[model samples]
Target: MYLTFWGVRGSYPVPGAATVRYGGHTSCVELRSDRGKCLVIDAGTGLRGLGKKLAQEFRKPDGATYNLILSHVHWDHIQGLPFFEPAYIGDTKIVVHAPRAAAKELRQVIGGITRHEFFPVDLDAVPADFEFHEVVPGSAFEIDEFTVLPIGLNHPFGAVGYRVDADGSSMAYVSDTAPFDRMLHKQHFTAGIEEPSDEDREILKTMRANLVESLREVDTVIYDTHFTSEEYEQFPHWGHSTPEHALQICQEAGVRQLVLYHHAPAHDDDMMDRIAEKFGLLGKEANVVVCVAKEKMTLTMGEVTNPGIVA
Candidate 1:
């Protein structure tokens, strides 16, 4: 299996010199299997770049199948769907996997994106036949040779973190989530549930556990690590985590390899380098260091080709 990071920024789009090294585009990732089958996550501006690459790679692009797995419908996450050239190609097939009940409707999430007052042409003018798969928490499905599992996370607007298994290799993609703060919601809505829905709590706990579980004896774990201790201190409610939180989770879960993700747009190469220095120090102490993902970098998983510690 292969992993590619097209976009890493979070919350909103911030493109400038400060964010270029780690990248400024929002969440978009492309995964490929040995057989050349691909799965994409999020459709941020990076997808525009990725689409161009795909068009070149697959010369006979007609009759190609495209799968998009969405973390949430926040504009930064889906803003570039219209920009993805594949959507406009009449022969390509695209399937979008998105959350069901958390926040915005599917139409509201992707409607008129291409030609809103902001852009020029509408997606309706695009030529492809689009199919959407609306997935809620606890749902599981198969695409090509992989199994995809979605679990809910603690976000102001609900987001589904994913666990994917392919050819004995496992990777968990949880782009936007607060480490552990649903207690606030429990506190806020104390009057709503008749008796503190044990099932709901169990699900939340289970969702958190899944993060650790994916790391348990797994190959790769890509998690959202978009904040520093300082920023995290001020924005506790935002759905993001610190590198320390990521390291601790890796330690508890026993994940062999960790790739920090969902970088903040303001953290340029210098600041990101400092954060890596801190992470390396912690990893040296804890025996589990993680490397940040860069745009267009490829991570090969499975025993034969991948060597020790890809950093």
Candidate 2:
């Protein structure tokens, strides 16, 4: 299997000269099996490019079959779906797996992004055959040659991290989450709530434990490191982690490689360089290979090919 990063930015797309090196698109990743079965994670602006590529590759009579697994329904995560060209193709089959909403069905939640008022085309109007599945946290499911386990995350409106096992190798995607020690997010946003109750602490402890266990000894981990320690201190409830927090999880889980993902919009290419250098050194001390995620970066599962990380 191969894992490829199409988008790495967080919050929104930042397409400018300053962000060119690290890329400005929001969260979208593609994982493909040896048999060419593809599973996509998130549908941020980067999905636009991925869709174009898929449109070219799967232009046969049968069209393409792709499964999209979303961590959450944040605008930055699902904003590119309207621009995805494959959806306009009649034979394309897209199976979408997303976190279940307490009030809305999966279609209502995901399809809202492509409503007529927002986009020219509604999701229902698309030519593709779409199937929506509500992913339950802690439940394991199979799609193609992969086994996926959703790990609940600490985020407003709720989010999920995924553990994907394929071809005897494993990779975990943990994003849009805050440090478990700080704020506890649920159905509503918890921006100003700084302190947690005794019960909240226990829940957070369990949440972190589950996340670490899901990533235990995984081949690679793409984690949300959107904030610096200084920035995280100011917005502890923002539901984004720092590199330090990510490293802590990797060290505890005995992960082999740590990919610092979900770059903040404010972090320019130079800032990203500094982050890569700093955490790259820290990862060395912790016996893990660390590198910052860049757009178009591809990694074969169980192999160290990206030169950014010293093997």
Candidate 3:
């Protein structure tokens, strides 16, 4: 299995000198099964660049086979769909697999950015060979060599995480959540600086438990670690988890390797590298690799077990 990151940004797209090291692309990831099945997740601005790359390397006389697994329709997660050239071209075939209950929500998300009010093109106007299907949570599906296990996540706008197993290699992608507790009890979120009512605390505990269950270890866990405990003070309830909290979750889940994903726009490459090292120190001799993802960084099932993975 080949897993490539196209974008790993949170909230919005940030492009400039400060964010250059992280490659300033919004959320999009591509996973290709050995059988040549293309699974694309999240269509953030980064998809535009990825589409350009695909045009250069994978354009065949026969159009590409692609499936889009959306986490949710948040602007930063779906805004780039309108700009992905492959989806606009007639030759490319795209199967959009998103939350069944919220397929309309997903469409609205992508549609908002492309509406004439915001951009020049209408989403419906795109001429790609396309289809959309709503997927059920906790359901497993197969395409070629990959089997995907879906789990609902705790986010105000609603989201789902994916655990994809391809030919015996597994990887999980879980992004965009305010530490589990906060999402369930929005009024008392730690970031919001409010004291939780007893009921709120109980609700938070329940939600946290559910989130933890959803992310319990598999193999490679790419998760939301966009902020440090210090930084969480500014955007407490905005729905991003801290590295310290993430470390705790990975440890509890007995995760083999952890990739700190969804970087803040404020952090630079060097800063993210430092953050990753800090996370490594917290792994307590476990195999922990907490690098922030970039536009072209590739991680696969084979790489995790290769050589020495110092915990």
Give the Cα lDDT of each candidate.
Answer: 0.74, 0.89, 0.73
Least well predicted 10-residue stretch by lDDT in candidate 3: 302-311
Local accuracy of candidate 3 as per-residue lDDT tens digits, 186-262? 32335354555778677667756765665666667788887888888777767778877776776777677677888
Per-residue lDDT of 1-311 in model 2, one digit per residue for the tens? 67788999999999889999889999999887666678999999999999998888876776777799999999999998888889988888889999985778899888887777888888998999889999998999999889999999998878999999987788989988998997788776554766888999999999999999899999889999999999988888788999999999999999999999999999999999999999999999999899999999888776433334311
> Compared with the true structure, what per-residue lDDT tens digits does model 1 show for residues 1-311?
77788987786777778777778878888887766678998888788889887766654544687899998777778887887877776688778888864355675556646546967766666676677789766778998987898867666557877878886787778777777634323213332222326676775677678767655766677778988978887776666788888778778877766788888877887888888777877877877757887777778767423333233
Q: Which stretches of candidate 3 lie over 4 Å from their true place?
A: 57-61, 100-105, 183-207, 284-287, 303-311
Q: Write down the TM-score for model 3.
A: 0.85
Clashes of 3: 4
Ranked by TM-score from best down, the candidates are: 2, 1, 3
Which pairs of residues collide in model 1?
Answer: none
TM-score for predicted model 2 compared with the true structure: 0.96
For model 2, the stretches where C-alpha displacement exceeds 4 angstroms are: 303-311
